[model samples]
Target: MGRRFEEIDWRETPIGAISLRRRLDPALDVDVYEVKLDDEYLMSSLFTVAEVELARLALAELPGADLDVAVGGLGLGHTAAAVLDDRRVRTLTVIEALDEVISWHRRGLLPLASRLTGDPRSRLVRGDFFAAVNDPTGLDPQAPGRRFDAVLVDIDHTPRHVLHPSHAAFYTAAGLHRLASRLRPGGVFALWSDDPPDDRFTGTLAEVFGTVRAHVVTFANHLTGGESANTVYVATHARPAGLA
Candidate 1:
């Protein structure tokens, strides 16, 4: 008999009802896991190319060793896992607003749960990405005013679209400036957007950072057929005059 769909776990977060579900995929002939917030799909193991690239492209921008990084939003831990793959990384702190998401990993309900929790370089932190950015000891409570080599974010669909109303402010000029201050002089900031790049947002980034780039990452979508693309926005905090 075919296995039935299972609701692994769920919680009533400050945002809304969030759930984790597991089901078998007939097409792929494997078990698939999904995360949903209220009526919207937050993430799925089936579609993670963009999440993986979000970490890769961000690290690619910062070419150095012993890098300190903070990844905003830990959906299924794909982005956090990808960041930990680089041997040069000295430390990785994943900031997640939802306590339930962290519990899933700690409870080993997620695929990369063991890998992420066991890794000496990685740690899951319970915090809000938007509010943390503006705080002095936002990313690291132990070390106030501490900065990282790069910050990779994939919380919302786009700047125009956010999980909460409070998040919309972070996409603006004032909010971005505070975020930039948390990075080192040559630090890199990368963002994953569901929609294509917008000039208005790019313009705002340009105002704060020395360099801004939009990367179109194409991946095969088995569900939709053919290929689909997402935008990865990359910016440098007073970048040096050189390429990685």
Candidate 2:
């Protein structure tokens, strides 16, 4: 039998707003927040296959190494939560542009976030991730480094389908170039897209990163309850020649 939707609560945030919805599935005993922009459903917490998979890919690419991870978005904290599961992570910095979303997590609206917030190794910054990345002042007092081991960006629905007009630049060639400069040697940059991106975005990644690969992860049929294919991008920078 399929699960049934239960109750939903609406909440406003400084960035925009979100709707917290509940499901009656005994297996999944929690509420999911749906990020909304002018009544449109932008992202949700119910199904986070792509979000979790992105973290897994980043960790896999940097095995046996203590990692300092920078996460761009904190929607329901699924991706951040997944990243925290890795024991190899030395520190995690989550930069969220929406103050209200941060407030929601602070007030216990998101269980995963609330749990992770208490961890000593995690730091949450309420600001624009782009500016934080580009700023050398260092957003976190504890993390005083120019580069991160992995940078996971989930700031938009996709590269082409940007929910916010300002986010458009982050996917462009120039925007990506700035992002690439923030990564440490051997660092990986991963992004989550609602679907596959256009050739321009992929081409730009190739131009900047040198080594790029895209992985498509399909959710379980029972979970989807329908047919859909989800994709995420994992691009890494190649060490310059003669650098070990």
Candidate 3:
């Protein structure tokens, strides 16, 4: 049987045209909310296990309760929704450069839209994640100088592969140091990559954080009819010598 797809909203963003769509997956026989940039598929609700795992795995490494976190890129609210699933998450500041993506959440086009936006602990901020990292004020524009226990980013495909030229900087050692500077001691930086783990990126992360590891998250591929995987790189920030 075939399926149906409906475009919920579309808008011109800084990079390209973004569209919010809902489609029925013939293979899964389920509704899949999709976010596309022009003709490229940005995210699909049907295959969000890796996205959800990105948040869960990052938060799992952290210890204790009431943890502050920041999520870069709000795609269909999967990652953000996963972060909120952890009761330890006291506050979540999601940074999205595209205002159109933010509007999708505000407009409640997706199932978790209202929950992610309306959650007392979550704050959806429309801004550039890369720019904010370099800024002395940090990601949350509302509360400057605030630091998070964990920063889970799933914007671009990988460090070597990126959607925009400007985002490439944030994947560098220098740029990552600036991001680490904003983290509280023992904080973590977790990133999602479409490709498998790359040693080059891990080396870059090691320059800033104490330890880095790549986790392979496997999921079913409807198109390929097999299991494929995505990589989640988690790096733990090390406190300065004698700082503690």
The candidate that wins on lDDT is: 1
TM-score of 3: 0.95
The deviation in Å at residue 54 for candidate 1 is 0.8
- Deviation from native of the Cα of residue 51 in model 3, angstroms: 0.7
* Each model's Cα RMSD: 2.1, 3.4, 1.8
Clashing residue pairs, candidate 2? Answer: none
lDDT of 2 by residue, 1-244 (tens): 2345643456665555566654555566554456665577767766688899889987788755578898988878888888889989998988888776677777776668666688777888887887665566543445564588889988777888776777777777788777877787778999988786456778888988868878887776446577555677888877778866
Question: Candidate 1 vs candidate 2: which has greater TM-score?
Answer: 1
Instruction: Tell me how many clashing residue pairs each candidate has.
Output: 0, 0, 0
Candidate 3: regions farther than 4 A off:
1-3, 241-244
In order, the Cα lDDT scores of the candidates are 0.90, 0.76, 0.89
Write candidate 1's Cα lDDT for 129-192 as tens digits.
8888988777887778889999999999899999889899999999999999889879999999
lDDT preference between candidates 2 and 3, better one = 3
- For model 3, residues 53-126, the per-residue Cα lDDT tens digits are 99988998898899999999988889999999999889999999988888888988779989897899999998
Name the better of 1 and 2 by lDDT.
1
Q: Which regions of candidate 2 are displaced past 4 Å?
A: 1-15, 23-32, 136-145, 221-224
